[model samples]
Target: MPVQPTPGTPPQATSRQQADSAQRVELGATIRRLRKERGLTLVQLAQRSDLSHPFLSQLERGLTHPSMPSLHRIARALGTTQQALLASAVRADPDVTRQAIRVVRCGEGLGVPNVGGMARMLGSPQLGVHPVEYRGAQTDFGDYFDHPGDEFLYVVDGEVEVDLLTADGRVVHQLAAGDSLSYLGGTPHRWRALGDSDRFRLLAVQNATDPLTGTAEPHG
Candidate 1:
């Protein structure tokens, strides 16, 4: 005799399990993509990350469960930070792709207020690429207002008073024209304008979180 389960329960349970398995598969695929992107073979990754062949194979095939530490090893072998890999995974997963990012402004000689100074994205959407902008600093204060993502700034004009907040807290930096700065986005940073110059311009690059990636990152 067969015992029927409650209505909708069985299907829901199956869906959950399937979703979990799919994510595992995507994680494996992401690892492999990164590996190939870095020109590393399975054996090379095994040696570099201190993982095993059959185990890694199983992971790549999404046929087994891997601990966080194990995944981290694979991540390191691929030469990319783990957070970026995880972010890729989230982006690849349809389950987490509900948000929409529409283009805002697109024109010449126009700038919008970003986390810091004005950001110019007055081109095609592809020019926007990842969610970031070219920011400028004025009056010694920096254009960064402390957000998330790793960042770099190449000074195109003027001097800057760059303040950075890292894992250890706040530290101020004096950046003159042409000085480059790179740091984590999660680090709180505020820049004050400096010298006789009224503003500073820099090409700011950062990989920002989509709404879904937000759950994993901290709120500033």
Candidate 2:
């Protein structure tokens, strides 16, 4: 026998469960794609991340979900941030077919949910380039970490200040809204919002690594 639901009402628990399942599958596919792009086999990734090979295989096959710590380890092993993997999972399902163009609409970018503050990746995934949008009250210089390439930042909305400091704690230059900066990466730098609003938005582009090979291309 079949039971009918009331009008305008659905099975909330079942619907939620289905949504979670779909997300798990999508995340698995994303991880698998990244692993292949980095030329890493399941066994290799497992060894690098210190996770069991069988567990990683199950994660990639959508048989299980990974905890935050596990995901972070996997991301580190893959030479990417956890934010990127999460964004990929939310933005789209795995697409092996390469596209000539990719589009992201207003309010439709992939949010970096795990990261504190508001940050999102703009547009579809592009090779060797990461375009990010950041909206927040301030940024910390201590959080200014280093990676392989260079960076370019533009103030898209509100006002902010950027500081470029030398290794010995000297401020080389400062930038305000409507001003842009480009510097070779590996230099210590950071920024913060200004004015009464205490809000700022920025568009930053930086070099990205290949998920399959885990190698970064030089970007100017």
Candidate 3:
């Protein structure tokens, strides 16, 4: 039989609420610690992460909770991953559920568009390697961009032309279905769709941590 508590009296409910409040406080402190360690003010972090300043302040004060996606952005701005921050939060909470494994269903990827295409984040809680699907990149040439860490790409559907612009010279590689390419980080590169297909699809996995912030390298 279920026990009903009279108005203004409930022990179990009160305990649960207290626990949740404590957890929120701990999470906020953890985020504040990380932000300070990175030498980032709330304004700087918010600008870099595309988050609003007031929201960040509220989060740091434990006055509000952030959704998973917002937490991911905050973690990235602090040079960490969402998985790491969640692990920290869980460590402080006594009522934690198992988090060793995660599964993302098909057609539910986080989609973000770039210069010439769409990039879908393959899974949540980004870890060591960031996996993304690049599709609908129908351009004659890509704006050369460079960032920290190595990159790998596999052509899953159609052919494409990739140009690797390094200090040595300009190298072009034409990739077809089932073709793959791996390149070192810091190499300026660009790509373009080929063979007259309406859309081109590729699986690009990057192991870079440094945020991309620059212009096209001069062709030399």
lDDT per residue for candidate 2 within 1-220, as digits (tens), equals 1224456765764443454455566678989988888899999999999999999998887677665447767987887754355445543423222652546555544444322246666534444576778776444332444444478888876766666666677564544567777866566566666663245777877766544444564433
Among these predicted structures, which one has the highest TM-score? 2
Q: Point out where model 3 deviates above 4 Å.
A: 1-100, 124-126, 208-220
Q: Is 1 or 2 the stronger prediction by TM-score?
A: 2
- List the candidates ranked by lDDT, beginning with the highest: 3, 2, 1
Per-model TM against the reference: 0.43, 0.58, 0.52
Candidate 1 lDDT over 30-89, as tens digits, reads 777767767889898899979898898887876676653455466556644333444354
Worst 10 residues of 1 by lDDT: 121-130
- Per-model CA lDDT versus the true structure: 0.54, 0.62, 0.63
Kindly list the per-residue Cα lDDT of model 3 for residues 12-125, writing each as its tens digit. 665444544555565677788888877889899999889999998987776676654576677667766443444344333444335523343454333444445665555222
> Which number leads on lDDT?
3
lDDT at 29, model 3: 76
